[model samples]
Target: MDMSSISRHEFRLEFLVTSLLFTAFCGYGLVWIEELVISEHWPLDEQRFWPGKSYDLNGYLDIIVAGKEHPQYGRPNILSLRYLDEVARINQYIVHNITVPVDLEGKHYEVAYTDLCMSFDWACYLNDHLTMLMPKSRWGNFSGPIAEFASDIINNEVNITYPIGWRGSEPIYFGALVGRPHLVDREGHFDHATALRLTYNVGNISYIWRKKLASWLTNKEKPPSGESQMLSETAAGEGQAHCCLV
Candidate 1:
């Protein structure tokens, strides 16, 4: 081959190789970024932790009432009458401020309290859910923190002061359950029983059942009152029973 042709061929080969390497590096970097985000925001364990039911307002109310009645499961002061009152006010505010689109059937349904709380600017849903699921022993003096959090939420404050141990930035849906020592021991060892309790009792089974009940209630054209009693009983049972585990 001519000298110029040989030189051109060499340059083309080098260019192709460099482009492939750049593309591969970019692909790897993207994958790593996605993994990091998922681990911090939605851990694999939490993604697997589906409650298998939709959350409705009544079911959440049932859970709140049950928590108030049985304070041993969570922070005693946070589950008091005052807390219930605040929650009711917040619910009203949400109903008025937020406009949820109606279904095709033209039946207007209020947003589920749980759904609203979860979507709220603050981490109210995570705080309440963890407070109820985690034993009171694990929670140390959350009364003051939770009270302030609730008040801020009620006042529609933009800058929220999150409770200790709860993530304010990059909120994780159920990342707390996995990060806490409840699933792992002091030496960073995994506890099988604790894991089972979290998976079956708190996350998988009980949570799923409550969600299902909530879904059923919201889906109904005219939900009956009898199910509320059953839901309340189930919530009470879950609070009392699940708290005793691990």
Candidate 2:
């Protein structure tokens, strides 16, 4: 073989060995690196939390075991006018585009002005941000269902009864138990000011819930099972929602 060819062959062999050794060194380094752990004092004082950041949900585990008195994520209630504007202006199209998973316990209740107002608000907010990828909005174009549900609510065809007074006449509701998945943006980037705001954990839970609900709407699947307990006095308030996110 020519001297140049011989040199090229030798260089190729050396490069392969060096590459293999580098990868092996990296693998060893990873095993020895210390892992990150949350501070033990996290739950005692929520000051350790990051605003609009989704931390481990283990902090709120007590609610799962709290039993009846503990409360669901928040009480269901009327959708505010501000929220309605969000739907028309922002998240409406977005929510209709994706799917979300929620252990929806109660029947898909009819809409009162309160219900439409709240969910429409969320839909609008969802549409504004949450690109078609990642945390993409998933509320489907169920105007028909919504309209029908609204009519039903108007006519009192279905029971407007949610034993939980917190959940008065709102069309949409959601929560997380102890260690399930959550669906929140936690960035405080979304327009929850108009819609009902939630804490970090609550927002995290809502993010997942909304996503899943969006997916279900996209697929036209029936709502999932498992019931959600309640929490807090006011319900998905903006500041409160951001808090739970962390």
Report every candidate's CA lDDT.
0.36, 0.30
Any idea what lDDT model 1 has? Answer: 0.36
Q: Report the C-alpha lDDT of model 2 over 48-148, residue by residue, as the tens digit.
A: 33321223432211111111222554422113233233323223332233334333476453322112112221331222211211121232334665866
Candidate 2, superposed: residue stretches over 4 Å from native: 11-14, 20-47, 51-197, 200-246
lDDT of candidate 1 over 1-246, digit per residue (tens): 699988888789789999999999999999988777756654424223223222211222222222222445442333234443443433343333433333447676544333333233332333343333333343344466696775554344221121212233433233323222233334332221111112112232234444544443343343322222223222323333222100
Q: How many backbone clashes does candidate 1 have?
A: 1
- 240, model 1: CA deviation in Å? 29
Query: What CA RMSD would candidate 1 show?
Result: 18.7
Cα error, residue 139 of model 2, in Å, equals 31
